[model samples]
Structure formats: structure tokens, C-alpha cells
Target chain A: MANILGTNIISSLGFTTEENFQTVKSGISGVKHYDAGTFGLPEAFMASLIDKEKLNDSFSELSIKNSYTGLEKAAILSVFDANKQANIDLSSGKVLFIFSSTKGNVHLLENAVSEQVCLWYSAKQISRFFGNRNTPVVVSNACISGACAQIAAIRALESRKYDNAIVVGADFLSKFIISGFQSFKALSPELCKPFDKDRKGLNLGEAAATVIFGKQNNSRIQLKRGAIRNDANHISAPSRTGEGSYRALKNILQNIDKGQIAFINAHGTATPYNDAMETQAIVRAGLADVPVNSLKAFFGHTLGAAGVLESIILMKALYGNLVLKSLNFSKQNFENKINISTENHFSDKKYFIKLLSGFGGINAALLFEKR
Target chain B: MNFKNSAELTELYRSLQIYYPKFFKMDNLSKLGFLAAEHIFNACTDLQSAPDCTPITSRREPVEPREDIAVICFNRSASLDIDTQYQKTIQDNDNYFPSPSLFVYTLPNIAAGEIAIRNKFLGETSFYVTEEFDAGQMVETVENAFSDTSINAVLLAWIECFERKVEVFMCLVDRNSKKSCIFTEENLKYLAINIKFA
Candidate 1:
């Protein structure tokens, strides 16, 4: 069994996991309109930007010269928390680092191309900062990279390849991401309303999340079974019948009792197709009655970081018995009858499943049981 | 599974051309994967009985709707477009003008995607980035693919494409067979020795 040593969150809403939970539990969202003139965001006003100055101050030596500053800070905090919780010396353990991000310091690359920077470093910069010289794996599988990285870490641990694996998913809002979303016509001008009948599209957000998985005697959570499957149906679109997601769900449900699963964190990107597809998958999994919530409304769509950030939030909820309300979810869609939590409902249940689907027909699902 | 030296590779390619002439003319990575896949396809012909004269493609058709046949491809080095991105970044004064064409090849799994697209094999595709080629990971990935009964075969390819040169080694694994053909340490040693003289 692999235990989550600890997790950290760095986003516009909160810097630490505790702060994020408090804000999300109270249904407080940090998504707002930006002047764009300040960051040269063009006409796009809405975004979730972390405090760069604060991040720089906290990680002075780490250097916040790029958009990955928040990600670096989040990684440090997560490792620190995990080290503290596990009470083990990381210097002695075999550290396998897996960095997940769709946009890896692309702003730095942009700046470098513009003659503002010197080099275009990859995601290895984060692992190098943590003194992890071992070959770090960079997973840039678009949006689902975060969850895919987690599943990869779990498999590596289970295979006895490494004693501990640090899985990090981080992505920040950039002109490239914004432009891509615009190209796809997937950005919402207004706040995102996941599962709501009137939901238009996803509101982009930025954040970095890190989770440490280790084999230990005392673990707060146990990663039971996980699966990564592809839809193979469409490259940029989700399956209309949710076959890929349903298969992934079925793979996870086969090992564990579906009724024991207390809460499900749906991918619910607030996009019509994604929400509808995930809803259908949930219903087909016979989890139609299970309480489900989407964190996109709280943090907007963090893209690559969505899976790890949401999983970390669910971990906190499982530890503290806190069920965060799904913000902006009012009315249900006709596709599924799942209970959408609009108010915080604490539960003592142990097992929670997190699901994510991304571009290229990649679908991944993970099950975490409280210890 | 063992590999041949340059001479052996030439022979293997010649042998493969007899069966798949179109694929043999492609890039080295494509040729390697095609060669390995042909071996597996030929091996599975007996168990999955069809007319002896039937073409391999006809026999390899998907029988089940949910059948899983994943391809996990790994490549460490950058593609030819890496130089293009670098040149653009240098010439344009560091403005983020990453060539979308180049960026698509930045990830290693695109090679597998190309193969899958060409073959019409709709299955799970994953790309893993490692500092160096790892036999353990290759075995693990093949094992994971085989663990699922639906996944009949996995096309495991390790390719490195850079400005200097391109090197690729690919093999196909099926759960039903215990025979080892390519990518084994013994084969690597044999190829290394042969290539040292070649």
C-alpha cells in the first residue's frame, strides 16, 4: 500500500492546503476579472493568478524568475509536509520525482524567445531545486497529466522500483493556454458553473499541487486500485457515450465495493461535453446516487494540476471529515441523477474515487481510502 | 529478445520487406515497430484460427468492442524540430514562438500515435520519459498491458531522435507466449558487440 505522506496547494485561492480547504469549504472562490494591462493578458480579464511577490519571498533562494514559481513553492511545501508527517529522512530514501504539467514554464520559453531570458528549461528545474538528481519523469499529457502522474507513481511504488515517489502537478495560466482555450471555444467569460443547467464553459485557473506516495507502516490514506485508459474515440473530444470513462470506472469498481465509495470527485470541467460525458459515466458505474462534487468552480480549470489539486482536497476532506460544497452547481442536468452537493456535508466514509479525462482521449481514475 | 548488429538489422529489414514492403521504407523507429508487430501477428495466427491463406490484417481485426491493445512508446532525445524551436527562439530574441509543429514532436509518444493512426489500432497510448533507456520499465509496461485480458498485445518502442542520429528498438509482447525474441540483455550485448565492429 502506498500512503500519501502529505500534500500542498499553491493557487490564487490559497497558498497552503489548509488555506485552500478553508476557502473551498466556505464555498469561497478566488476567480475574478483581471485588468490584463498589468500582466499583458490582452482582452482576457478572468484568471486565477498566485501572488508572485509572496511566492518569491517564501522561496527566495529557489528563484521565481518564471511562471513555475508557484509550482516550485508548492513542491517544497509538499515535500516538507510529507517529510514531517512520515518522520523519515528523505535524504536516505530513494526519491523518484514525477513532474506533471501541460505548460512547463512556457512563459519562460516565451520570454527567452523574446530575449528576456537566457534558457528554456524543462520540468526538471523543479526536481533539480529539490536536489533530486535522479532522472525525473516529466508527464505533459495535457490536462489529465496530474492524475496520470499519480497513477504512474503508484505503479512505480507497487513495483518496488522506488521507496518513495514525489508526484507534482502544476500549471499556470498563460497566453498560450488562454489562446488555446479560445481556439477550442471552451473558455467561459463568466464564472464556471459545473453541473448547472446554465453552465456555459470552463473558467481557466492556475495552481500547483504535490503529493508524496511512500510505503510505510503508518499511512493516512491507502491507494487501493487505479487505472488509466484511453477513449480512442476522439483526439480533442470526449466520447459521446462515455465508454472510455465507464471502462476506467469499471476497472476501479471491480476491486472495491461501489457502495463503499462515499464521495466521487468528478472531472466536471464545466464544459458541456465533458460534464455530460462524466455524468453519464458516473450513472453507468451504478454510482448515480453517490454524492459528487467538482472543484473547478472553486479554482477554475487548473488543467494539469486539476487532478492532483482535487485529489489533495479530497485527501484533506477525508482526514478532517469535511465535505466541500460544489460551488456554482445549482440545478442538475438531464444526463445523470447523481447527488450534487451544494453545501458542505461531512462524511466518515473511507474510500473516495477521483476521475480525470484529458486531450488525446486519455482517461484516468484513482481510488483512495482513508487510513 | 536479442537484436542483430547493423548487418543483422539489414538482414532483418530485408526479411521484413518481404512481408511489409510499405512499412520497411519508413523511418527507423517505424521500421522497428513494424518488424516486431509482424512477428507477434504471425505468432498469434495459430491460436486465432482463420483460413490459412487469409491475410494477417484480416485475421488481426478487432473481435470485441472493448478490446484493449495499447502502445507505450518512449524516446529520450528531441526530434529534428527541436533545432527549429531552438533556432526560432534564438533568432526571434526569446519571444515564445515555439513552433507548434515542433512542439507536437516534443513528447515521445507521437511516434506511437503515428503508428496507431496508420494501423487503425484504437487502444490506450502512453508515453513515458526517462533519463535513459530502462529495461525494467519496458518490462513493467509490457506486464501492465498484459495484466488486462482485453489487451492482446503491446507495441513497446524505445526511440531517440536528435540532430546527431536516430536510434530505435521496438518489440511486441503477447501474454500467451513465453518466447523471448528482442530487447533482452543478451540480444543487446550481441548487437553491441556486432555494432562495435560494423
Candidate 2:
């Protein structure tokens, strides 16, 4: 089995995995409020905007910020940080780079410079940083892009293809993405309250997360199984019956014992439809009683980075033997009751499930085991 | 649903007698993917032979249906044609209204969703944006999609549209094929560029 050797998160709260994990664990949120000037909104909106000064400060330490785009800077720095901790030689040809991003360098679209708007160019440039030999694989399955990348890496590793896989997901909030969400009327005016009765909508955030997996055991966490299911229900709205997500959960839970699952890290975007669908899905899968939580309250919805960053946090939570609190979860919102942890809880079990559903009626569920 | 190379995709729709109203609302990229998928599915499954028409989802029955086919797609310019349209909506200072119709098709994966829904492929579907048609990356990703034991076949599509030109190559990869050619980068590139391959 491939083991996650190293992980790092470049989020609003902090730059390193340990730093962001500790900040969120301490019940401190990184989400801040900004008005009309930001993203050109007519009204105010809440988002987990990464502190530019803090990022610039940390990036200057690496002294390589100027050469790359803002999104690329975050990704390269996070992967570099993970490599620094794990001592993985990214330059080695034995490593396979799998990059995930919904919209990379898309901010260039405002200038009408259509030539550079391609995600392929951005992916190639990022991989060149490590002097990697193999052509990198870019997954663009909307929000599930990151989780899909890890699954792809696991599959490639099982084929005895590459020695290690550097799975990095990054997306920056440009006027393009923010305006699109605003047009959908999916952005919450206040801090997102996931799994709450008063939950209005989601807040978009930008982040980059990295996980290094090797065949040899170096880290405690192991990815057991993953499944991606399409709803075939609608383009943007998830199935009200949770058909797609339920199927994904059912596929991953086939051989595994339900009792072994300690907690579930849900997508919980705080959007009415998404939150409701997740509730029905968890309950339908018979995982309703499990301690379920969402990290959007801490970092908001980081789009492409949500899956990878949340998975990294899950590894940290499982390694630390704690169920990270689902911040802003106060009241039950759905007809099917779910166990959303209001406060941080302790658990002895070593396995957990990660769930994410995206715009293209896509749903993904992954099972993780810690040794 | 016969497969053939035609510059006029509308002619295929007329020939097939396809009447899905949503097809008209779709952008050129999605229309290309939808048509390519329609032709491939008809060929892979005996659509013409079976008059009653058993869905592709049920044709591979008794072995479970959902994970039977994984849709893997790649593109060069992505949704460049539709993106230009969407950009114009928000670009105009007086209009300032972003048309949700155009906004939805901006991502290339929406075309993949259209294919999955129409074909009823419940398994994994991922879209990769490539600068150019790189056969190596497409072949490697297809191998990864087949890792799941339940994934019996992969509908690999290389759909791209930029300016007025559109190129779509949809190949059905099933291990149960009697006359199936070897799955390789060279074979894919040859088949993609050349429309007619028996």
C-alpha cells in the first residue's frame, strides 16, 4: 500500500500543515469580511482570504515568488515545504507529479490575454520547478479534482509505475471565479455556517495543499479506497435523494466494516442544497451516527484545494487521535439527523471517510486508514 | 448513430433524428462531445441491432452497472469558444450581467457531464486540459481509471474546440473486444487524426 509520506497546507490561517492545523484546532477561524471593492461585489461577502503579507513573508523566505504566478507560488511553496519535511527529491525522475486545479492562472482572462489562460501551461511550469522528468497529470474534475488526483496516484502506484507521487491542488480566487459564484447567489454574506439551520451559503477561499505518497511506509495514514459517482441528476444541483453521493459511499464501504469508521469529513459547503444532500447521503449510507464534520468554517470553501487540504487535515486529526470540531455547526438542518461534532472530540479509532460533491453532479468518497 | 468524420455536425444530428432540446442550448464544445459520445455508444452497444434498445447501463448487467464505464476526456483549448461568449457578458460595462447559461458551460467538464448523463455512466469522469494533444498523458491517465475492478470499459475522448474548428475523437476501450487494437499512444494519435478506422 502507498503511504502518505508528507503533507502541507497553504491556507489563510497559516503556511505549513502544522501551523494551519494548530490554528484551526484552537477554534480560530481565518475567514474575514470584505466589501464591494473585492471581487467587485455590489454588497459585502465573507471569505477566508489568505493574508497577502503573511504569504509574501513566507514566500520571500523561499525567495522564488517572482518567477511564478500567484497560484503557482502557493503550490510550489507547499510542495517544497512537504519535501523539506519528508526529504523527498522532487527533482528525481522516479517521482510522478499529479497537479489538481479548477482554474489556474485564470485571472489572466481579465486582461483578454487568451494565449496564457491554459491550465496545461500552468501545470507544466509548476512541474518544471522540481526538474521533474515525467509529464505531469492535471485533474480538472471541478471541486473533486484534488481527491481524484490522489486516487489516480494510488492507482498508478499500485501498477508499480512511479516511486512516489506528489499530489498538489491549488486555485486562486480571481474575479472570474468569485463573480461566477456571486452570479449563482451561492456566497454567504456572513461567515459560512456548515450543517447549521441558519446556514446561508458558502464563502470562496484560495489555498494550495500537497501530499507526498511513497510505496514505502513513512507516514501513518493510508488511502484504502476511493470512488467517484455522477448524479446524472442536474448540472449544478446535487440529487435531493443523494443518489450519486450515496452510491459513492456504498462503493467505498463494500468490504470495509462500518464500525471501524471513527469520523466522516464531509464536504459541507453550507449551501442549502449541498448541505441537505450530504445529510441524506450520510444517512442513506448508514454513516449518519458517525462523527461528521466540515472544515469550510475554518478555511471556507477553497474550491480545488478543499479536498486535498481537508484530507491533509484529516491525516493530522487522525494522527493526533482527535476529531476536529466542525465549527459553526449549531442546529440540525435536515430531516435525516446527522452527527455533526459541535466541539472537538477524542477518538481511539484510526480510520475516517472524506466526502466531496461538485458542480458537474460529481460526488467522491474516500476511505483512509492510519497505522 | 454511425461514426463518421463530418465538418457539419448538424448533419449528423439530422441523420440520427436526435430531438433533445437541451442539445441546442449547448456550446460547440459540448455539442461535439455529445455527438462523438452518441456515435461511440451506438457502435459499442448494438443499438441498431436491438430495436427495443437496452441502455448501455443495463447491457453490462449481472456484473453491476454503475462502474462499468469510466469517462476520461482531454482537450487543448478547453471551452475557449464558450468562454469567449461568457466573457462578453461580464465584459460589457453597461450589461454587467453574466448569463448563467454561458457561465455554466465555461468549464470543459460540463461536456463530460452531458455525456455521462446521456450515456448513464455512473463511474469516474475526469477532464484534463492539455496544451497540445499529448498521447502519452492520455494513455497514462486511462490506465489509472481502469484501476477499479468494476470499471469494465473506458470511454476515452479527446474533444477540443477553438475558433470555428472542432476535433472530437471518442474511442471505446473494452478488454472484452475481439477485434480491438492494442491500447498505445501511437494507435490513439493515428485514430484521432484519421477519422475513419475499422
Candidate 3:
């Protein structure tokens, strides 16, 4: 198992991981009514938008070229944090970069059409910025991209392909993404309420989060076991039986005891199909009694960034010995009995699992333990 | 896993071109995927008997949706349709009815979809996009697939579709072969060397 030295988060909640943790501890809601005149999205008010120009000014002049200012800064900060704990040099040693995002400057497309200026190019641009010319992987598995990115990084590390890996998951609000989600009727007009009986839909948010994984230094968290499985049942819809999600949980449990998992960070999108499917999967995994919380209420749905964004929060919770409430939960939706948090509290257990499901029936589960 | 000759390889490419002309032109990822699928189909003549032909059929046999057959594709350039979709949306006053032409190709793994729908082999399908292709990850994917007794064969390819050009190297690997011979960086280079560019 590779050790997670540290995690850094840059989101609408706050710029740094510490700041974001403080916000989470205080139960501060980062979501707000978005009113950008330039985009002409007045109806879409609630969102978690980062100050792009402000973030760019904080970095070197060369880093501000593309729309990856937030992602670049987050990566540098995470690497810096990891470097402080471990005795490793990134320049001399190989570092596998696994980046997850849904829209890598998809906003750039509205202005012009060029193959050189797409999301994959942006990933290369980041790699070049960090002087990492080795193998860099960009994962875009829709909503599950972030979790999938972590799984890929872990596999790379276990394969001994690199000494350490820098995993980043970032996505920003763009007219392209906003319009797409709205067209699908997946966007919420008001604040998102996960697991709530009256929950309407998700409020789109943007964030960039970075986590460094390597040999266990003095880090507090360790990624024990993880698994990614496909439902193979539907393209846009999740398996009604939650068979895929259940398989992921079952696979992870095969290596580790099911009771060892203290909490669960679910892919609670506040959608009818997604939430119901996840609930059924939890029941099938026999984790119905576990305490689970959905972070989408606070961060909205960051899509590709959700995995890292939620993971960062989970790390902070483990570090601070706290389990934040599920934000908005009125009553249980179905017969599947599971403990959903409605208040901010801490837990004694150290191990937890993060689950994510996306389009094409893609499902992934990651197990994390405090070092 | 080993190819007999370059002529056989050219025939595989020709088959892919005939099936998906638009995708073949869009980038090298699709072209390579098409080629790889054709090679795997031709190599495993016995498994080709059980086809689940549906609306997405391209060949006579339906590609079985079992654990034994897996489609693993890698790409450096992610989405090729985002640019086209963005242009159409902006020009059409951002009216946001997704361009089906662009949306159809937005998925990096739709090449697997094309192959699955055509071949009707619905097994384990996975798509990975890396900054550059990693030999270790490719080998790991193969190892994982082979761990399953049901997955006797695996189709692996490294496909890149960027700018206007496409480059692909695909192969079929089974328990019989100690290592992959059809799809390696060296074999791909060999195939590239044999191409007579006018």
C-alpha cells in the first residue's frame, strides 16, 4: 500500500487545503448564486467558482498562459507539501502524473478550434511546466474521473514504474459544461441537497485538488486497497441492482474486512437514478450500517474534480478526527437503511472507502487508512 | 500474437477503413483501434463463432460479452469532438442542442463501442488516456484481464488522435504467448517503416 503524504485543495470553499479544512469544520457552505453577466447564465445562480485571475497572479508569469492556472497551482502546492515530508527529489527521479478532469479548458473551444489546444494538450502543458517528461496519464471517465485517476496512480506506483506519483483532479465551470449538464436536466436551480427526500438536482461547481502518493513517510493516511469495475449494463444509466458498485465494494472487501471501513464518501449526485443506485449498492455490500456523508451538498458536483475534492476533505476529516455531516438530509429515501450524517462530528476509526460511478456504467472504489 | 506478414496487416487496416471511414479519418486512435480489432478477430477464429449481433453489428459474428474478451485502449489526445461541438454551438447562438456528430465521437473509448457494436463482443472494456503511453500500465491491464479464466484473449492498443494525423498499434494476446508480438512499440515502428508514403 502506498502512503498519501499530504493533500492540497483549491476550490470555491478556500484556496489552500488548510483553509478548505477550516471551512469544512465550520460547516461553511461555499456554494452561492452565480451571476456572471459575460456568460449569460443568470438562471444558474448556485455554484462554487474559484477566482481564476487571482490564482494566476499568485503563480509564475509563465504558468498563466492557459486556463490551467488553478490546476497548476494546486499541483505545485501538493508536490511542495509532499516534498516537505519525504526525502525525494522530483527532477532526478521519475514521477508519474495522473490527471483527472472532465473539461480541460473546454472553454477554449468557444473561441477557436485547434487540436493543439485541447484537454490532453493542457495535461502535457502542466507536465512540461513541472519538468516531468515521464509517463503522464490523463483520465476522463466523466463523473468518476477523479477516483479513476487515483486508482491509476496507485497502480503505477505498485508496478514500481516511478518512485512517487502526483495525482491531480481538476475541473472548472465553463459554458460548455454548464450548458451540457443543464440540457440533461441534471443541474439544480437552487442549492444541491444530497440524500434529501426533496432533493432536486446537482449544482455545478469547479475545483482543483492535488494529492501526493509515495513510500510512507511520516504521513497520516495510507491508501490500502482500491478497485474499479464496470457495470456493463447501461451507457448513461447506472445499474438498477447496483451490481457494479456492489462488485467494487466486494472486491475491496476481499482484501480488507468490511467492518474495518469507518466511513464512506459516496457518489451522491442528488439525482434520482444515481442516488437510488448507490443506495442499493451499499445495501448489497452489507455496509448499510456504516456512517456515510455526501460532500456534493457543499461542493456541488465538481464532476472530474469530485474524487480529489471529496478525498481531500476526507483526509482532513481523518486528520482532524471529525466526520462532517451530510449537509442536507431530511429523511431516508428508500428501505435501504444507512446512517447519513446531518451534523459535523468526528470518528474514531481510521479506515474509510470512497466510491464513484460515472457514465458508461464506470464504477470505482478507493480504500484509505490513516498512517 | 505474432503477425505472419505485412500484407495481412494491411488487410486488417483495410477492414477497419471499410467499417468506420469517418472515424478512420478523424484520428489515428480510431484507425489503430479498428486495425487492432480486425487482427484479434482474425487471430481467434474459434472464439469468433459466438457472436451477439444487434443494432451495432458490423460483422457476421456477434462479439461475445464475456469476461474472457476485454477491450483496453489508450490515447494521448482525449476528446476530438469537443472542438467541432464548440464551433457548432457557438455559431448556432449557443443553443446547446449537442451536435450528434461531435457527441458520438467525444468519448475516447467509443472506438471500443464501435468495435463492440460491430463485433458484438461485450466483455470487459476499458479506456485510459495518458500524457504518453506507458508500457507498465498496458502490461498491467493485460495481466489483470488474463487473471480471469474466462478472458482467454485480450485486445490491447495504443491510439493517439491529435491534430489531423492518427497512429495506432494493436494486438491480441492469450495465455499461449509469453509476451505480446503483434502490438509493441518495436512492431509498430516496423509497421510504420513498411508504409510507402507517397
RMSD of each: 6.3, 3.7, 5.9
Error of 1 at B66 (Å): 4.9
User: How high is the lDDT of residue A42 in model 3?
Assistant: 30
Question: What does DockQ give for each predicted structure?
Answer: 0.17, 0.54, 0.24
1 or 2: which has the higher TM-score? 2
Share of true Cα-Cα contacts across chains kept by each model: 0.11, 0.50, 0.18
* Candidate 1 vs candidate 3, DockQ winner: 3
In candidate 2, stretches whose alpha carbon ends up further than 4 angstroms from where it belongs are B1-11, B46-66, B177-181, B193-198
Flag the better candidate by TM-score, 1 or 3. Answer: 3
TM-score of chain B of each: 0.58, 0.80, 0.62
Q: Which model scores highest in lDDT?
A: 2
Would you list the rank order by TM-score, best first?
Answer: 2, 3, 1
List the lowest-lDDT window of 10 residues for candidate 2 chain A.
A36-45
Model 3 TM-score is: 0.82
Candidate numbers sorted by DockQ from highest down: 2, 3, 1
Q: Where in model 1 is the C-alpha error above 4 Å?
A: A37-41, A61-74, A111-123, B1-56, B59-66, B77-123, B132-137, B140-152, B159-169, B176-198
For residues B1-198, write the lDDT of model 1, one tens digit per residue: 235343554577576445434443344444455555556655654432112222234434553333356777765542322433533432332353434434433333445544554454555667665545656555665665554445666667666554444556655555544234454545544553554411
Top model number, DockQ: 2
